[model samples]
Target: MSIETWLAFFVACWLISLSPGAGAVASMASGMNYGFARGYWNALGLQLALVLQIVIVAAGVGALLATSALAFALIKWFGVLYLLYLAIRQWRAPAQTMTLEHRPIGRPLSLVLRGFVINFSNPKAIIFILAVLPQFLDPGRPMLMQYLIMAVTMVAVDLVVMAGYTGLAAKALRLLNSPQQQRLLNRSFGVMFGVAAGLLATVRRV
Candidate 1:
């Protein structure tokens, strides 16, 4: 990829990461429950899923998956169900005062897995990547190297964006002093997750 093409892709990466989706909801949810220090593991899991998606696209499996109605439906339903599960969990979270120091720490691996599932199950992401990544590809240049660059660029941007989302929620948590306030915020996040699931359920291959 030339410098100009790479630069354009880099900008696109930021925009993609900034867009609100299941990943953002997961990040904020984790941050709300845990603080930035532990919640950031969710971002790592998200990056892992992202890299895998890029690899799938680069290897051309994304095209096959996109065309397969059964595969797409399976993945899409899984994602929707998972998001609804998350929403229910959030809704049922015990009401407590907002105190990061006093709150019990969540297992990092569980958070990571949560993040991975949130991204990995989204068929829309695979299709989006399949459509977008090829636009910057140079048929005259080596393909593997271009894919590697794009993957790295996308992951780096997404990490930063997820961190910002997580941190923002953590900071917001500090302002809520009562259990009522905490419960309200938690349920709000639950609703957000449900909304995300609804949106995901409506996605169709383009």
Candidate 2:
């Protein structure tokens, strides 16, 4: 990829990372539950899924997925169901003030797995990657190098964006001193998750 092409892709990466989606909701939810230090593991899982998506697209499997209506519908319904599950979990989450001394710190691996599932189930992400990433490619150049550059750029930008989301939620945790306040926050996040699921359900193959 040329410098100009890479720069444009870089900007696109930032925009994609900044967009509100299940990934952002997952990051904020983790941060609210576990704090920044522990919750950041979720972001790592998101990057792993992202890398896999890029690899799939670069290998031309994304084209197959794009063409397969059955495959797309299956993945889309899975994503929708998973988000609904998350919403219910969030709604039923215990409302209690989190403190360093008494906070329930979730296993990092579990958090990572949760994040991975959240991103991986979203067929829209892979479809979006398939649609957008190829625009930056140069047919005359080696394809692998361009994909590698894009994968790295996307992961790095997303990490930073997720960190900000996580940190902001963690900071907000401090203000939620009462159970009532915490309960309200939890339900609000539950609503957001439900909204995300509804939006994902509406996505169609482009």
Candidate 3:
């Protein structure tokens, strides 16, 4: 890709990532509850999902899935259900305070799995990749190589932008001196997560 093409791709992906969505919700949750350390991982998980999403779309896997109505519907419904589940969990769980001595109690595999489901189940992610990427793809280049360049450019932008979000949220965490305030912050984040999930479930597919 030309320098201009790469620049444009970076800008496009950065703008998209800036949009408030599940990834942002997750980042905010992580920052509010666990501080910047966990927030960084949350951002990492979001970027990792983007890489997989871009690869799936670029290889024509998305085209195949788009063609199969049953497959699409099944995935879409599953995404909705997953979001609803997350909404309920966040709503029910009490607020948690972060400390230098204590850690959130979840298995590593389970944590990553939840991250994957939160991202992968969202069909809008696939659609976003399809719609945003090809506009800048070089028709004269090898398709796979073109996609690899695009994916790298996109993920890099997403990571940096998401890290920025995490940092800003972490700054807010520094203000609270008491566990009670931290608990309230946690509940506030939970409400935000529930709202995000509800929004996702109700958004009609185009």
Q: Which numbered prediction scores highest in lDDT against the true structure?
A: 1
Candidate 2's displacement at residue 24, Å, is 0.5
Q: Is 1 or 2 the stronger prediction by TM-score?
A: 1
Please tell me which model should have the higher TM-score, number 1 or number 3.
1
Candidate 2: stretches off by over 4 Å: none
Instruction: Output the worst ten-in-a-row residue range by lDDT, candidate 2.
Output: 97-106
Give candidate 1 regions above 4 Å deviation.
Answer: none
Q: What would the C-alpha RMSD of candidate 3 be, to one decimal place?
A: 2.4
Better of 1 and 2 by lDDT: 1
Error of 2 at 27 (Å): 0.5
> What's the CA error at residue 5 for candidate 1, in Å?
0.3
Residue 74's lDDT within candidate 2 is 96
How many residue pairs clash (N, CA or C atoms closer than 3 angstroms) in each of the candidate models, in the order given? 0, 0, 0
For all candidates in order, the CA lDDT equals 0.93, 0.91, 0.71
Q: How big is the RMSD of model 2?
A: 0.9
All candidates: CA RMSD (Å): 0.7, 0.9, 2.4
Tell me each candidate's TM-score.
0.98, 0.97, 0.86
